[model samples]
Target: MQLGDISVNFVELVREACHKLNVDPMPVLNEYGVTPETLASPKARISISRFMRIGQALISTANQPALGLFMGQALRISHMGLSGYAAMTSPNLERAIRLWIHYESLSSVNKRGSSRFYLTEESGVAQFYSISPYNEFNYFVVDCLLSGWSALAHWITGQERLLKEVEIEFEAPPYAQHYQQAFNCPVKFGRSRNALIFRKEALLLPSIYANPATHSEIVSICNRELTTLVGATSLTERVKQIITPMLQGREVGLTETAKQLGLSEWTLQRRLKKEGVQFQQVLDETRKQIAETYLKATDLTIGEIAYLLGFSSPAAFHRAFKRWFGVNPKPFKDQHASGRTDENTATGENT
Candidate 1:
């Protein structure tokens, strides 16, 4: 339960990338204090700084500045471990993207910055953008993310998609040609944003593993993992996780949550106060998050949704929904069904 900052799974990817170029990765791993065991663990992680150091090492060892593109191309959903399986089993590309956004932190953590996806109906495209602190390996991160998206989409949908365009925040490198060729699209460097623009229709493709029954089961598993991830990292997340499932059939309160966490009510209250949160605040936030998901992803009736969230009545749920979102639940669900989404809002970093 280390809840690693970067998934150790990336070690295999880095190794594969180096092997393809006939470069040995042992030196880099040794230099960075990474080990074969670290890479072998499905749950261990390395800090963000160390991850970047390793990425730099991989690039230098391979003698290729565009190593990220190559590594991403070699990645498959199966390589993502549990996170990958969840995405592969999601109903569609869009749903899979949302699920990944929601559960990403269960596998890795991002320190530099997070990523967001914005849909522009007028442009007929969706833009996946990253907000990261400037660093030497920024391009590598961008390349891997964009190319990874392409690769994952292809794997899930059995369709090849060429990005509409790729934007980089830095100047073009000497190997910019490789990027252009790898993405099979125009790669623009020195742009204000690091993003991959794709046609909206591409997100509508059906996943080969799409099954309503399986999707629900996988999501439940993801929720449990997310709970574990937060429990290891933050008290707030642990409480939220506890509140999520319990909201379905029983009253969730500080007393019950504290008991579940093996702490006294007073101790739990004090801990949350130390974290600058109150029990009520966490409960409300958790409800808002789950409410949005149920409205958008499921066909449950408003009354049923309300009951599922442990609200006594649909009217009670409506009142709370309005307070949280400035709109009623029905309208919110309608907007989501119509293809409108919260643009700047996402559950986790793009990775």
Candidate 2:
């Protein structure tokens, strides 16, 4: 995989934007080598830099201010390869999101389960929310997701109701104003989260093709991408990024995990594979070793250790630890302390 490929996936949004705006924007995608042919395939995955390039094209062409409008109009079913799958397998807008949450990352390996699209009923209104929290490619993720959220709204209902609001945590700047009309709704910035909101009734709307076999094919394709995602350095970098922060609540994404080292994520993956190890195995093995070291050499609580290893809960940590060492952490800690006492007593007698 190359940056060009990843960029290509994101370019789908730009491509649609150009079409909706009636602007010929081929040169932007062409500059990065994202072709119509490459995009037609749902399983094709690409690189980060190329996606950035495509984003630049939109930023330039749409005028930085109108970027959101360009983006909002760009998101659609045809772009996500969900034309058949979203309609059939999902049963409704809600179920379709469940599939999308699990499978949407497959459209481009760039996201890899770091985003969301849903309708939340709260505060006297049903709200639609879309998010991309786990991505290193924030600009690309936000742009792609905002557009997809907008597109999904149209797909769910023939009405083409725009998003209720789009919120981002980034600094409020010249880039913020353009999104206002794109949503044909409200937009908020410098907020606590990055997400898009809409009405709840949108969940009941369905897309064009609701067929089973085609949906299964889409599932199969996305599954393969998910499997390939494992052991890749991208996975390793994410683990390290998340783990480092959980340990210190410091900037974990800042240090290169051998994945964050490059402008292109695929390059990091290739480099790791050349080194004879996949990111997933390295992450798991590293965590297990670290957990053991923490258990034996430190007095940190089990909860802290679990969080340090990036597990969501202590039970998860214990299970993983047992699987790795064949012993629970409490017993392991006790045994280490006992050994330390024996050695200390022996040293005292010698003295």
Candidate 3:
């Protein structure tokens, strides 16, 4: 399955964490082709694989394994963008959480499926879908999400330690103790699901930022944005479809792509800009997604895959693959071949 992309807002959070740690994040950000201008764009996004590489880079630079926890603590409601605004204006925490979940695609896209919320009369369980075959590169993703939700709940209610308990899908790492400190509750590892358990009554608490009229207005705005997002996604998908069959040891430039789409190069650029993406960004993302699928799901040799994806050479493909996933393609393919799913084997560098 093709992985999805995360909003550039997440890159900002990583930058914030870098500042808190007194580590300069520019070198790493630049290495990933992210800039202040890119982050300023509300529609900018990074592929999930690329973001994982960034997280791994930051963790190494800061020498901090628990960076995701720090990031989670730094999360503010406004960081979530429109989905956050909708939640902030909702009349109660329960409705706020539901609204946020419903509109989450506005901020990030996870093709595995969005997080799920199961509400009972006495309790509510907020479950994060597993992005499993866990490794150091990805465990922090779960950490940031589960703890970020806890932090958001506390922020909305003006209360601390709102979770009854936390459950993680993987075994406890060496930094497992930090999970408890982060959540301020019993955290069970090796559980069937990654979830936050909460008191249903607590969910009924009125949001500190709640307003009936403002919520109505924000929900209306979110609806419009969601519609726009869907339309923009269709455009991106069309571009990807055209780019796919063209990559065969040859570069697919924007002009060529525009010709294929029956539009002038300038017109194509304008449309993509309206969708919050550049032509080059779509091309690169398309290559990364296809490269990953080829490495994971086929017996194609590295040179063949590289040729198929239009890389100049196998060595060049090696460099790009490392840049995309923070690992050499050979090891990644080998890991999958051996069915090695242990989180303990994931050291962030090679995983």
> How close is every model to the real structure, measured as TM-score?
0.63, 0.54, 0.69
**Model 2 whole-model lDDT (C-alpha atoms):** 0.54
lDDT of 1 by residue, 1-351 (tens): 111156766666877888888999988887666677666655666654456557887897788888888888888876676778788888788777666656676666542233556668722232334323244555686777677766776778887653677787777877778886677777788887777776678778789988788778878888888887665668887777566656764568888889988999999999999999999998888778768765764445788678767798899999999998999998888877766322221122221
In the range 145-194, model 3's lDDT, one tens digit per residue, is 88888889989889875788999999998888788789999999999889
- Model 1 scores worst on lDDT over the 10 consecutive residues at 342-351
Q: What is candidate 2's lDDT per residue for 1-351, written digit by digit as tens?
A: 111123244566667766777777777666555567766654554454345445655666755545544665666566556432554455555566666656544554331224555444541121222222222223544655665666665665555563556676665655555565556666676676666665566566665556567667776766776677554545445444333333322223323554344435566556667767765676676677667655654456788777666677889889998998899999888888655311111111111
- What is the overall TM-score of model 1 with all chains considered together? 0.63
Best by TM-score: 3
What's the lDDT for residue 70 in model 2?
A: 60
lDDT of 1 at 253: 85
Cα misplacement distance, residue 7 of candidate 1 (Å): 0.3
How far off is residue 130 in model 2, in Å? 12
